[model samples]
Target chain A: MLDGFAGGFIEILQIATLMTMFVGVIAGIVASAIPGFTITMAIVLTLPLTFYMPPIQGIATMLGVYVGGLTGGMISAALLGIPGTPSAVATTFDAYPMARKGDPGRALGIGIFASFFGTLVSIIVLVLAAPPLAIVAIQLGPWEYFSLIVFAMTVIASLVGRSLVRGLIAGLIGIFLATIGPDPMMNSPRFTFDLAMLSSGLPFLAVLIGVYAVSQLLGEVEQMRSGSSKGEALIEERIVFRPLSYLMDTIRRPINLIRSSLVGVFIGAVPGAGGSIANLLAYDQARRASKDPDSFGTGVPEGVVASESGNSSTAGGGLIPMIALGIPGSAVDAVLMASLMVHGIAVGPRLMVDNPEIVYSIFVGLFIGALMMLLIALSSMRYFLMVTRIPKHIIVPIVLVFCAVGVFALNNRVTDIYLLFFVGALGYVMKKMDYPLAPLVLGVILGPIAETNLRRALSTSEDLTLFITRPVSAVLLGLAVISLVVFLRHRMRPRASADS
Target chain B: MSDPRSNNASGRPDRPEDDAAPQPEGISGDSGLLQFAFNLVMLAGFGYLFWEAMALPESRWEPLGAGTFPRVLLGALMLLNVIMLIQSAPQARAELGHGPRQLFGVAWRTMLEFRTVFTVLGAFGVFLILIRPLGFVIAAFLFAFGVQLLLGPRTWRNLVISAIIAAVATVGLQVFFAEALNVFLPRGPFS
Candidate 1:
């Protein structure tokens, strides 16, 4: 067993491992620092380039990008008051305020520390939860799996803002796109439009980039054009590391860590919802629990602590379902799932029995990754903070270029570039029209699973009512109906009130 | 970059939910035009998707035809557009009365306000194009330096420092991917 671990990853343990770590740490910092340039987007864009590399290194590089992107967001949120990604939004409520109050150093310090703690807790949860979850997954027939997808889609509870109709429309659009490519059952093509590339359907990464990155970029462009000062100053008077006392204080607020970590883990376990909502829920909980609730939006270090910890911890939480059920729980996890498949690493229960080394390596990597983040965050704090001084004008173009390169680098087909721009235009138009992008993304990710599984489940039963006959499927379908109704009700109430 | 730090942080109540909420304010000016343009585009996209779906070959499973999902999507979209049109019906008058003032107001405001944001996005796009052909190391290094420059960090010291940082970062990533994870870096023209 030791030999398996040793032999398979022999190339990694040498100097190359150190180099990869360095790259990951640096990439993490940069991607995190840049607003709207998410780790998932970065990894997706870079993955195609990795096609030329050996499997292990390619996976490691992407993994490095993942870790880097996750950790890097704390830098901007704490120092500059901007959350680089949705996950970091909670971090901004406290970190930015703390930075402004002249303790940017303290805010950043506590954030990194809390992040480490939350991550540690999550890793433990993953180790305990993965195998059991995998076992339970064995019971999931196509009917059960379809029901689970229905349950996942029900997460529209969180996404359904005042504009539920618009959100649903976007989601339906995503499902339609999922109907593209070939049918798994009858070897029939669904919506190929006679185009060969479309036969494979829309690349998940392209859709992801379009909805998440391009739409965001366009929105940013609009926001930038609205006249604002480009003034620069360091709100933080000092930046240093004094860890022990802070650790003790965090321990004192054990409930904060635990509550937020649990929120992260649960949300992570739920497919499609991802860390964005977890971080938000954690931030809300932190505020509700604070001795001074008003202090939250104004920049309490506790707010920063809860949020950074909550969101970062979801990395571990998200891996649970993917490893156990072969169902990706977030975009990054989805990419990781793809990587595992690329490396011929089977997911689900069989993987547990067959590949203990890979599993153990992952467990070890999670532990080591968290430690690396702490050390890297501390040493790189000053450098990351300096990013705030870089003007917006320069940053946007660079990001756009990276997106272009990243998109094209994947699959070396020039057609992907055309797809990127087409999707970009679609994204720009969508943003202009005020349609939410998240549902579209979640739908695209979850659609195929829902559709194919539903068809298969129905096929087996020869009964349309079979969905309700099975207890688990019936319950899941019930929940999905109830959630959709609830969301629609929420939407209707607002419009009725507004009109009245 | 409005230094979100300065936004009335005296433990003040949030700037009213309405400000943050998506409610349309005073049905005049750019908002109206934007609404119209977007409405038309969405209408067309949805229409095309629906049309294409309907044209697809039918299967034995009638309800679950290839075009079923797309048709359903377009139907929903068309309904949404109708609702949006109703909401925006009041703005029709503003369209007829308002001249260049309203349009320019939104344009000029965006231009002056988000200059930094524009530069950043633009430069990033350029960096991506240059990267594959130029090699990851050089492209990344140049990209970071370019961003710093566009952000107005003009001194040679700042430029050189950022360049070194970018170079180190690119090399570090390359080494990690190539040696440790076994990812091969694009040799580009350098090799």
Candidate 2:
């Protein structure tokens, strides 16, 4: 393992790998700093480019983008008070306020330091958590795997935003969509309805582009028509980055930094919960834990530290589940998994045994990427700040066209583009009506695994009751039921009374 | 879909100051009746799919046939849809008093409100239909220009610039994909 890791580090230091990583970092920073452009989109678009490269370079470059994008979000959050990404929503509560306080440099600087700390902490935790989890996952049977998916699905219902029913429905829709392809066991087509497109199943990349990018572009158009178009550039003044001064300021609030990062890591490790939840919850916890809770949203350094650290750390935390169990921690992790799979690397319990070199490279790559992000961000802070100058008119249509390019690029199939448009329409309607898209994607990914396991277990064993008789499976099922109950209780409560 | 941050889940700001009026689990506004109508349509679709699954021939080798898994899923979905209809009934009932004209106005207003979304979707539809016949370059150029024009800033300069941009970007991407990346993009006779 040590020898492999050492070799992995050597490979990561190669010129091609380093150059791609640098380019990825630049792209990630720029892409994510633009509001409506997500890390998932950045990673998805990056996939086609990475196909020809060696696995390590491709994965490492994406990782660089992952880390860079997490911090990149803070730029818009601070400068324009519009979070560049949903994860940066909490950052805006304080970072924007701080920037508005006439020290935009301090705002971004503090955020950068906090993000660095968060990533560092998360990497440590991921390294600690993944191996043990992987070991346990390796021991699980088909029944246990099916049960675990159920538990994950149930937990999704509770935390997946405003509507519990909508969340569940979204998940069910995903599972249904997954059922459209050939049956895992028999390879018999199930839901294709005799269409050529259905025979291959819905491509994840097209759905992702349709759901996120297309809908977001449409949303920008909607925002424009609403006459509240963010037409003018908010920052024209010279922007600066004072790393030394901000580093000192951030270090003074060690408790906030540590707590928020821990929060981020925990949330990131969960299946459905992600950076958006992490940032907000970390900020909330920081406020509650503080003596000066009253000062949370009003330009406080503590607030900025908490939110930025919380959001950034999730990158590492998200890697934990993906590396350990072959279950993607988030949509971004799903894309990362797809990238590795493109290289024909089997990702699962035996990933470590099969490919220690790749695993170790990822670990080392995380650290190196962090160092690069810090250096690149601190140096090019002003240049990135200028990216905000690009107008919405240019951005919206261009991005939509780019999304079409990405869709066509994926399979070179025009049918996929049609599917992209169809899914985009669904996404736009769902967004307008407040439906969650995550559960659908999750459902799509996990549906086949769940079904294949269930069928396998049933066929292998005589009794269907074995699922309940088995200890691990029973326990997992119990947890799933408990999650459902909790979701119900939360939904049923008269929060209206509490609000008053 | 858009945010992928916290907003991905709810399609709204995660930390809205007004905690009292929590966003509805279903579609917002005086649209419970509309939602219910949509649900009925879905229910009918699910029912048809369920019936089709029932007809799927089962093999003797596997204990659970291929249709079994999907049947289970469809059953669960059918149940959920029924439950949702029941839950939405009260709200839908309350909106029944709204006159047809009032409801029509609301629906029409919604369509107008979401004109950009529809227009963009239309552009994509046109792009998809044209891409094979006209090829990616021409289709993309037309789609890009139409989308921008509909979205506006439609001054003569913007239109000319949009046209030039549409042409350059399309050809540049095609060349990069074909030459640099060694991937084939659809080429029309003009290209």
Candidate 3:
């Protein structure tokens, strides 16, 4: 292990490790500082480029980006009312309020500080949890793998929010869309539109960029046209980072951090649940736990803490399933999985057995990356906050331009550019209406998995009752049904008098 | 157009009671217009999608055919659109007056100040085109400058900085992917 680190570090130094870290942090900050664009989109667009690089360097760059991106989202949320990423959505509710109250410094400080701490906790879990889980995963057969996918799919209802029916509809819609490409198992074409590229199915990255990034750009443009004023740009005050003191203080509220991190890890452990739901669930749990719940939506530090903690932890937890079971736990992790394959690194149980040295290297890399993220995030919180002071009109165009380039960079195809615009429009409308965008994104990411497996299962059994007859499938199906019922009942309930 | 049984969700109270009297403006500000516009656009987009899917080649299998997934998605999208339109019509009219009046008015001044989106896209387009001809460094420099122009920095200092950002991003990507990972980026004139 020591020798491996020594070799990896030597290679890392030769590859301009500091430069990679710097570039990653900058790109992450820019991506996270802008609304409509996300770490997932940034990572997705960049993944193609990794196909061109050496394995270790490419992997390290991605890891750096992941850490930086997670913390960067808080910049916009703290400075402006807008959240740079969905995970930061909870952050904005309080951070923006606190900023408005003229404590932008403290708000930004607390968030960055909390994010650094939370990420550290998650990294520890990743280091410990992954190896054992990989061992357990080795015992699984095709039936178990199929059941695991079903279990992940059943979690969709929990993410659906006020409308499980709508969420299911969205999920089904996503599954249907996933069928556009050739079948994974039989190599038979499914829904190719006679166009050659369609045979490969819809490019998940293109869809992600289109649905999330482009949609956001269009929405901002529309909103900009309406002449909204964001008030005076927030002025920053001095914020001291007392890490020891901060740690002690946060440890006193260990439940909040532990609870949020666990929720994040769990959500992240499930393929497709991703960061958005993790942060949302964390925020919800935090609010529920707060003695003065009313203060949550106001300028409370706990909201910032919970969101940053939750979202950052997801980065660590997301890699667990991917490394252990060869299943991507989130979109970014999906990129990681793809990158590994491109580099001829076989994932799953065999990866650990064959490349224990590399596995240990990755663990070390991730741990160091987490610490670096915390250090960089803490020191630079003030700078990120300053980014929010830029005018919305200015920020929007810059972000949009980046989005276009990023999208085009993926496949260098004009079709993807158009896709970006189309998805941008869809996102704009969805935002304008109050429909949640996370589930749709989640649906797109998870759709193919569900469809491929469902078809594979059916083809193997050729029996309609196979889903119910299998014990694991039956359990997952039951969970989905019960979740649907619970979600509907919750939505149907009369509005709470106080909130109304 | 004004069917009495429409049960318009946009219906404002007609009562003249001074306190509870509906505002003179109709209910649901201009959301009705917005919603209608949104629905029309979605319809057009999804309609094309459905048509395209229908045009695809079919397989011998019933559900596993080439057009199976797109057709299913198209149908679901159309259904969802219908429900959304139906749901929005009433709510749009009801909330018409409550919508962002100023957002649409002259206050939308900032959008005109800097045409960042177009310039950035144009610059990026040029970058891709010139990558083979200009080499990574040259193309990257132009891309940076173009993005800076789009950003509309008030001073040359900021413009220079923005340009540097573009250059760095380009160079970094080139170095990592091409030099390190050995992935091919276009090596035009300057390469």
TM-score of each candidate structure, all chains considered together: 0.66, 0.71, 0.65
Tens digit of per-residue lDDT, candidate 3, span B25-100: 3222124445445665766777787887776665444345455556776777777767656655664455455556
Locate the minimum summed-lDDT window of 10 residues in model 1 chain A: A229-238
| DockQ of candidate 3, scored on C-alphas against the true complex (2 decimals) | 0.10
lDDT accuracy of residue A477 in candidate 1: 88
Q: Where's the lowest-lDDT run of ten residues in candidate 1 chain B?
A: B1-10
| lDDT (tens digit, per residue) of candidate 1 on A1-500 | 56645644564454665566567657766766655456776677667755665555665556666666776777766765555665775576667667667666677778878878887888788888865653454556788778877776765434433345556666777766676777655556766778866776777656655554554544444544434532233442444545665566566778898888877776676665556667766775675456665455566667777887788788778878877777877888888777778767787656657776666556555556667777887787766655544545444434444455445545544455446656665655554455555566557767877766766675566577777887878887897787667545654674599889
What does DockQ come to for candidate 1?
0.17
TM-score of chain B alone in model 1: 0.71
lDDT of 2: 0.74
TM-score of 3: 0.65
Candidate 3 residue A392 Cα shift, in angstroms, is 2.9
Query: What is the CA-based DockQ of model 2?
Result: 0.30
DockQ of each candidate relative to the true complex = 0.17, 0.30, 0.10
Global lDDT scores for all candidate models: 0.62, 0.74, 0.60
Better of 1 and 3 by DockQ: 1
What is the C-alpha lDDT profile of model 3 across A1-500, one tens digit per residue?
A: 56766765665554465567557766776667655457886677568767777776677677777878887888767765556676775676567667767677666766766776677777677667876653443444344456655654554544443433345445555566566667665566655556665666666555655555554444444334333432223343443435555555455667888888877776677665667667756775776567665466567778777877888888878888877778777889888878778889987867777766555556556665666776776666656656556554445444554554455555655455555655555544454433445456556655665556555555565676766776656776676566556544543553454357
